[model samples]
Target: MTARTLHVDPSNAEQARSWDGEEGSYWAAHADDFDRALRAYQRPFLDAAALHRGERVLDIGCGSGLTSRAAARLTVGGPVLGVDLSGPMLRVARREAEREGLDSVRYEQVDAQTYPFPEASFDIAVSRMGVMFFADPVTAFRNIARALRPGGRVALLVWQGLERNEWFRSFATALAAGRDLPVPPPDEPGPFAMSDPGVVRDTLTAAGFDTPELTGLERPMTFGRDAERAYSFVSGMLAWMADDLDETGRARALANLRVDIEAHATPEGVRYASAVWVVTATRP
Candidate 1:
């Protein structure tokens, strides 16, 4: 969808720009790689949802529709709606759903934080590493809760602290190239926004959901089959890290990233430890 027709909260404007622009384009292009990287979390996250047949599903921030498609399959005969701010990723999601012949799945380009969803219409809401970037999470979640029926479930997979996520820590450190990068606040609108269990619990409670249950889950995230391929994938995803560096520093940073990624290479693939919280709650 074009910007003219896109609806988003004022607080989420910056995020909308990034997710709908180059960042979104890159993710859409490498959708398979991303899906594979996070494959280990799929079964567990979905399992937490405990979906039943004929249960309407709302997939928030459903990039590329991996989880949404899976939800559709699990809730056969039930309608599934996947919403996101990125038109490019939504396009990929739509195409994949069509290719899978999932007539029950539909996609929309809209911000989950402020989208006017049909009230009390959904049986469950799920997000895979997708709910943490909300500028106002409580408000975002409140919106989600309103869209759900009483007793409707909400399940989310969110990254743990950066220190516990080896993939991010190692990559960011290597990319820093000895330059100290400023850290965003723990509760900022980013990947680690919901990392703290206490914050997550509080947010959900304030948003009109039952106290959230945070379950710790650990897994190995695969970047690519080999170091070179992993480097290409990672560098593409985080090249902005080195954007302010000089020529020599940028080269050095890239070399450091390659070395670090190579250290994680295994016979099967380049993998690194990742910790996440599988948060579950019920709408009151």
Candidate 2:
């Protein structure tokens, strides 16, 4: 087999490895489940983009290509390109796109922070629960800006904050019943990295985007089909979190999490209140 070369940014090296390794595999394996959980964010994110017919689109961190497929359906006159850092996730994205017979949608396994797209090639860029993991947000956004035509727009959905998202906080607290899990720094390269609107606006402005519009949205996110299923899915997905614990400790954590999930169960599913920011910007 021929050797492959990657041109990922040094700042994103660790994330590229993690997303291209076990984490990516796990996400691909449970693609449908996670899709269901985050499905509520899709409509709002897309509405904010207001994609036009014939607009060339780019999807950043397009895990499993769900949003890419959606964009493809909207833009019949032009193709949609979805780029991500995870090989396994891209594999799943390709499979799903083929299964759905989405001819205009394409998937590329690349570090979007530095991918050299033809200048002014795209008319719009959209991300659903993506674009928040960049180690250098400004550099990444700037690189993306270079790919857009003049007046091109960007729409993204980002988690509002740790305290506002019960899905993560409840599960985290449950898992840490015995162990003290340190809170990650607010500026860490994680989901809530862009929670602060001021930082997001400043970063986009520095990256050549015009003043951004932010809208706070709250929605119900599904965890699973039922409480039992939710517990099984969540525990398995986060099993690694307790891998460092003793056997008894791991068992206890799982048991406590199970009870907590059960209490929040409804006929629809184990639902949680999630808050996010629907941010939109335009290149000058």
Best by lDDT: 1
On the 0 to 100 scale, the lDDT of residue 14 in model 1 is 85
Backbone clash pairs for candidate 2 read: none
The number of clashing residue pairs in model 2 is: 0
Worst 10 residues of 2 by lDDT: 1-10
Over 142-200, each residue of candidate 2 has an lDDT whose tens digit, in order, gives 99999999999999999898899998888888888677787656687888899999989
lDDT for model 2, on a 0 to 1 scale?
A: 0.88
**Model 1 error, position 154 (Å):** 0.1
* Runs of candidate 1 exceeding 4 Å displacement: none
Deviation in Å, model 2, residue 61 alpha carbon? 0.2
What are the per-model C-alpha RMSD values against the true structure?
A: 0.9, 1.7
